[model samples]
Target: DKYTGQPLHNAVVWLDLRTTELAKELAKEGGQDRFRHVTGLPISTYFSAVKLLWLMRNDPAVAGAIREGRAMFGTIDTWLLWKMSGGHSAGGVHATDVTNASRTMLMDLKSCEWHEQTCKELGIPPEILPEIRSCSEVFG
Candidate 1:
């Protein structure tokens, strides 16, 4: 939530299993290994992706923000980097590295980029995803 100091939704930790059902639902779409080949991960709550899907489905505020284009999605590293660069008030940097992006299950491992098709399938809007950059890139 680089756009605001206080985010509407709290971070969903990796250990949370609340999205297990959501993952199962996703698996039903293309099997658990649906995105495994591209993301190197299966559809599971172990990643950030399904957690986000849960939020959007169950939380009206989150869904509204995303629908209105007021939401920005990313993992911890992206948030830290954005804040370090001045946050929303200072036109914070909105980006993430392949490593963090990969954990979201939103990235195409091979291209080190957001997988738009997968995002669509999962109901995640790519417009809200952070830019994918190399780990070596200077964010500041």
Candidate 2:
């Protein structure tokens, strides 16, 4: 579940090589597909934000966590970085990589940041959103 009270289960974190190959296949099958160009990866519901929403709606603990700000919402990369950085609550480096952010449908494709409108549309709070960053940048 995400810190935003989003429920998540069976979340799949696609490995870099696997994601790349999937994107290539998708591009080959559907020539000039914008998904591959924009995201640099194949689109998959498994790696995205829908599950997070589900968790938020169903899990009471998750809902409380989000409200407290003690929980953080992030993709796999962001979670990893937070854990690696000592998980400090004050400035714990909560963030998400561009590619992972793109899959969420919550991030603006162009700005690479959480979209307020999207959050509202999805019944999510902008407050719990993760900071967006480039895939290569270090979070620590």
The candidate that wins on lDDT is 1
Which regions of candidate 1 deviate over 4 angstroms? Answer: 1-3
Cα error, residue 91 of model 2, in Å, equals 4.0
lDDT of 2 by residue, 101-124 (tens): 887756767778777765674467
* lDDT (Cα, tens digit) per residue for candidate 1, span 1-140: 43565586888899998898888888998899999999999888899889989999998989988887788877888788778888889988889888888888888988888898889888899988889988888888
Residue 39 alpha-carbon offset, candidate 1, angstroms = 0.9
Model 2 worst lDDT window (10 residues): 1-10
Task: Supply candidate 1's per-residue lDDT for 92.
Answer: 86
How many residue pairs clash in each candidate at the backbone level? Answer: 0, 6
Q: What lDDT is reached at residue 109 by model 1?
A: 85
Worst 10 residues of 1 by lDDT: 1-10
Q: Runs in model 2 with CA error above 4 Å?
A: 1-47
**lDDT for position 52 in model 2:** 57
Name the top TM-score candidate: 1
